[model samples]
Target: MAWYATGTVAVTNGSNVVTGTGTQFITNIKSGDIFIALDNGLLYEVDQIVSATQLTLKREYAGVTNASAVYEIVPTTSNLKTLAQQVTDLIAIYQEIPQSATDAQDAAAAAQGYRDTAKTYQDNAAASASTASGAATTAQGYRDTAKTYQDNAAASASAAATSKSGADTAKSGADSAKAAADASAALAGNWAAQASGTVDGANYSAKYYAMQAAASAASIALPVPITSGGTGATTAAAARTALGVPAIASSNTFSASQTISYSQPLFSINDTSGTGVAVLQFNSNGSMVWQLQKTSASDLNVRRYVSGAFVDVPLSVSNSTGVATLAQRPMFGTATPWDSANLPSVSGRLLNIQVFTSSGTYTPTAGTTKVIVKSVGGGGAGGSTAATSAGQSAVGAGGSSAGYAEVLLTAGFSGVTVTVGAGGTPGAAGANSGNAGGTTSFGTIISCPGGSGGAGGNPSAAAAVNPSAGVVAPTISSGTIINALAGQPAPNALVLVPGSVAISGYGGSGPLGVGGQGRQTTGAGIVGAGYGVGGAGATTSASGAAQIGGAGRQGVLIVYEFA
Candidate 1:
């Protein structure tokens, strides 16, 4: 076969395996066949036929790896010869005939010379025999010499016959080789001619048709016909005309309503000066009635077309800020009560509010442009009252409230770290001071310090005991404060009627929470009621018992996000 190229193949660089797709290697190819890769025009000898779609090459693929590559498999023979090789062999065989013929001629000449020498020796022996009886020995010697010459001649003639036979056999072999070479040439020519079939008229071969197709593609006419899925006209105007569509600037009016929809922006205006305006107008009988205009500043304005001129409607919306201006207030429908809950939210209105009681990262809601942050530090714990003996009394001071701060943050805001302060631990019994509250912060933008703990009360043996001092309010540390306020100080312990009628101080209150009440009898202090509030102090009377202070309330961070 010329070549088996039924399907494509795949090969990897530096690999000996060849994988075929839709190929019939087992049925159409075999070992020792020539494999050619059309991708790189590289040739390889098939080493083994693994399967119908697989084979092995004698050598590894040396070119770039390719998949679904065109290839060919040409059948081969063990002793295949080319035209040059056949001619060379024929010449060699013919050369052998000449050499053999020359050898035969030389042998025949040697034999004739030996025959003449033998005849001369026979004549000399006859002469010697007739001369004398003593010459008889000499004649016999001559005869023996003639006999040796004759034997030599016979041997030479036999050699000539063998040489002649070899020459004839060599000639016949040469003739046969010539005939085989000529037949091979004729067969090759036939195959070549068949591949290059006549290209005249409709009887063109594959190659001829391929060439014609390439030429035609190279010279295709511009502006393909509409039947071929293209506009028949070259220019846009002509094309629109041919499609029976009106031009964008045409004055033709549509008899029926038409809708144009597109996935992308319908159109864009590229204004280099940043001052271009677009307008849409409603007309009746060639006279404009109303018009909507996009101004050079990107603001929208409504206008009424009066007699020979357009008048502004006193209504315009800013595109950059989304702020609207109106000359008159808008009237609301009585059907829906315009309460705070029912009011429609305008642009830049509050979208959501988040309150955090624990430390966490705060992510703004989508489209939030600004956030209002309000933070309060934790409240301080109350002081404990000292234990007293019988007929003695004690009272403790109340804790101070936390600081409060607020800020408005806008621009370049992302994930903000929020930290909520925990409440302070209560003071232990036996005249111990209360623990200070923790600090609250909103990222690095704002921070509020917690309140200080209250002082412990001293045991008094006398009927009149001095009251303990109250706690001070906390301070603000960081932020561009929109509003900041210090917390309220705790109340001092009261000593009415000495040990028997003493009362503990009450805790301080904050913006978000209420303070705890003081104890009047022999008991422990009460805890804070809500966030950012101070705890109440403890008190003891006739019982002379020790009392512990209450814990402070935790701080809070509130975020009001707006667009």
Candidate 2:
């Protein structure tokens, strides 16, 4: 006999069994395999095998366990006639069997092996589907978390970039501060080199360096509070003092670095001709404040102190040499006092006077009167030639000259004569040459006038021929007289009011006369001959030049303090 291998099996009680023609190998079964069946309306599962013919099984009904059951096998037959006959006989015995019982028997026998195998495949498919779903869910969660991390990192990077830019700007400001300090130090060293005095250079140098450091620190926008830097909360005067400024008044609110502007006199000026005065103004904390008037006609610029040194503010103008700037030393403080006891003997000399107080009021002594004389009236032209009918054997008189005088009338001088010199009465226009200007005097003095033109000589008369010389009117004459040689006058002269020495009168234009040899082409009489000059008129002062005028020289103030 050929050896055959067989595996043990346990049959479930409710399962069915059928026989086949070929030997059933049941290849997928293991030692614990079980088969269940219902027979005679009872459930049984083969629990053990003794031999091919007989086996032991457990029987149960309605889910009851541990019932006893025995299995028996018959010899193989082609039609299974023996098993069929047993079933038929049992059915006849139980004539009351229902159709459902018959159908169940038939279906069990037809599909016994296939149903078991199909159930095993279905269960495995369900388990695999559940496992795949879990895996997919887990993968999606990981991806979402990773994306969140990436986005956060990008946001952090952007924030970091912004911070970096801020930091960089702060660093640049620091660098600028450092450079400012270095420049200040170098300036101090240069000052030492140029020092003329035999003082302690080391001490001065140290003071200068300290000031520079403070200023530089203040200029920089430091992140921390600047307790020791240049003045912000502190006043400019305090800062200047701390920086060792020499001899500066403590009452002054400005620093050496700050600009000080001069105020202009309001009422005095030359309507006749010349440059006008512009009030000086200082820029403090980005605002302009009045300073002082220009004493002399000249261009002016602002100066600022940087690191204990004075530097000129950049100025733009034509012909700027000899110009005065704010930072230059010897800034005018106040005016001097007037001394009439020392009356100047010179005819056209000026005597400046100042008021002790800013109000500029003075109670004059009984004998003396003080007033600012703006302009003297023009002297009259001299009389024309005495020749008549083209000079028929007659010599004409020489033309007279004009006179000018400026005086401070005393208290009792109300009787003082005031005569305005008119131009000399023109001679008969046909035969006489133009006459000379007249002399004007207030008291014992006579005013000088313009020189007159000479009479034209006749052809055959053989007489004394007089040639006219161009005359020079007194530059200090009444109606703002002019000298072409003098440039623009000071601020007090052009802008201040009358009766106050604080006010000065402006100089006049070139003398009114014939323009060159073209006598007919002479300009109509006007104050100034230069460009932008205003016509001679009351209340209208000279116009400004392309540049400004010199600062006014300070006046003298003699105070008999009653207080």
Candidate achieving the largest TM-score? 1
In angstroms, the error of model 1 at 422 is: 1.0
Candidate 1, residue 92: the lDDT equals 36
What's the residue-level lDDT of 312 in candidate 1? Answer: 58
> Residue 262 in model 2: shift from native, Å?
44
What TM-score, computed on C-alpha atoms, does each candidate reach?
0.39, 0.18
Residue-by-residue lDDT tens digits, candidate 1, 23-135: 98887787777777765334577998899999999998855578888888756543222112222232232211112223334434444444454445445554443443434
Pairs in steric clash, model 1: none
Off by over 4 Å in 1: 1-345, 463-480
TM-score, predicted candidate 2 vs. hidden true structure: 0.18
Candidate 2 per-residue lDDT over residues 410-496, each given as its tens digit: 232233343343333334422343333333333333233333332321212232323333345344323222221211111111112
RMSD of each: 42.7, 71.2
In model 2, where do residues sit more than 4 Å from their true spots? 1-369, 372-400, 408-417, 433-439, 443-453, 460-465, 469-563
Q: After superposition, how far is residue 131 of candidate 1 from its true place, in Å?
A: 99
Worst 10 residues of 1 by lDDT: 90-99
